[model samples]
Target: MAESKFEQSLENGAHQKIKSLVGKWKGTSKTWFEKDILADDSSSEADISSILDGRFISYDYTSSLNGKPLSGKMIIGFDIPYQKFTFSWIDSFHMGTQIMQATGNATEKGFSILGSWGNPEYGDQLFGWRTELEIISENEIIFSAYNIMPGEEETKAIETIYKRI
Candidate 1:
């Protein structure tokens, strides 16, 4: 007998224990656009909230890089037919809107979210954009962004380490 895809995903999501990620966090982070150190910043905060019983989660992020404000939100579905997450960000300073899909699971260190997405505003400035989120704790996380130009190599757009307040 073989387990169904839904069954497998359910087991995976259950074993992942993503509920440990619910909380509020504060930390400093830096933003690099196209591997060119755009700014080194730390005035940022992140809030993560979730309802395990409801199978819903949300992330609210607010930050400033070089005096410009950046904000984004992510909504996730857990223990469902398909375990996945969705993200959307509107960056006022960079003038970009980013949307991404993610798959997550519990790990020894924390929850790991592997995702990929693109930014329309930076399409010309930077190509083939994607991001990764590593939840270090209930209040700590690391976010890294990547971009690959048509002819040039892939670059890390941003890497930020966050901590709980």
Candidate 2:
């Protein structure tokens, strides 16, 4: 029997690349609340691991915002049928009580995903969030996110550079 595409990926494709990220990482997180304005910069740590026999990758991280403790988890997978990447994220400081789900395609060095969030009480106003992960080298990676508002351009919200530890 021929190997399924996903199975092939697990052996030597995108899944293999994703699995390479499994490890301990230490880095610094920089956040911006307004365009061109730095809000906070702090140390951050993360653990990346493969789950479900390498079908998915989980990123669990801890940091701080405005001197308050913050933590987040993100699960990422490749959808073979859709030919896209799947991502779901939640965090203590940003998500509040909501989970952000996103889908995107692969980039040259990584992937970029877009998601949105809003409150019904706001009456149909939703904000966009874009996350990007770039693997620079065996020991380095860069993670970034942008915030998009209605009728406005996307602004860099957060960026973290990690080194494998």
Candidate 3:
């Protein structure tokens, strides 16, 4: 007898890779607005958990931005039918009133998601955002981002280095 693709994915698939992120972590994050110029540095905490019977990973995190409190929730999963990773995120600081959605796949270390952020004042694209992650080990991870704007060169917006606590 053969098993269905859905059943096979549920037991062993890309979702397993996403599930590896579950844990508690503490780290430091650096924010930049210009090339090689550090804008801010702050401490961060990550609380990751598996939800809906291991179908999705929900991560909650906290930190500070420019001396104010910052928090966010990130949900990640693998869509078996689509064969790509899915991500939905929202934060108290960056997202004004919108949820940032992205889709990408697992890399050698972690995963990267490319998505657009910001709404046009008159219906035009404002900017693009890419979130990249690398899990060096079970206890250590690196997360970074690239912000793309029209005409201007790409820039690193934030980089977070986290370790299990």
State which candidate, 2 or 3, has the greater TM-score: 2
lDDT value for model 1 = 0.60
Encode model 1's per-residue lDDT on 42-75: one tens digit a residue.
5677777865553555767788777767777766
For model 1, the stretches where C-alpha displacement exceeds 4 angstroms are 1-17, 36-38, 51-54, 77-86, 90-126
Best by lDDT: 2
The top-ranked prediction according to TM-score is 2
Worst 10 residues of 3 by lDDT: 4-13
- Score residue 81 of candidate 2 by CA lDDT: 86
Worst 10 residues of 2 by lDDT: 117-126
Evaluated at residue 36, the lDDT of candidate 2 is 97
Candidates ranked, most accurate by lDDT first: 2, 3, 1
Candidate 1 vs candidate 2: the TM-score winner is: 2
User: Sorted by TM-score, highest first, which candidate order results?
Assistant: 2, 3, 1
Tell me the spans in candidate 3 whose CA falls farther than 4 Å from its real position. 1-7, 10-12, 121-123
Q: Considering only N, C-alpha and C atoms within 3 Å, which residue pairs clash in candidate 1?
A: 26-165, 32-157
Tens digits of lDDT, candidate 2, 88-161 = 99999888899999999899999999999988886698999999999999899999999998789999999999
TM-score of model 1 (CA atoms): 0.64
Candidate 1 at 113: error in angstroms? 6.5
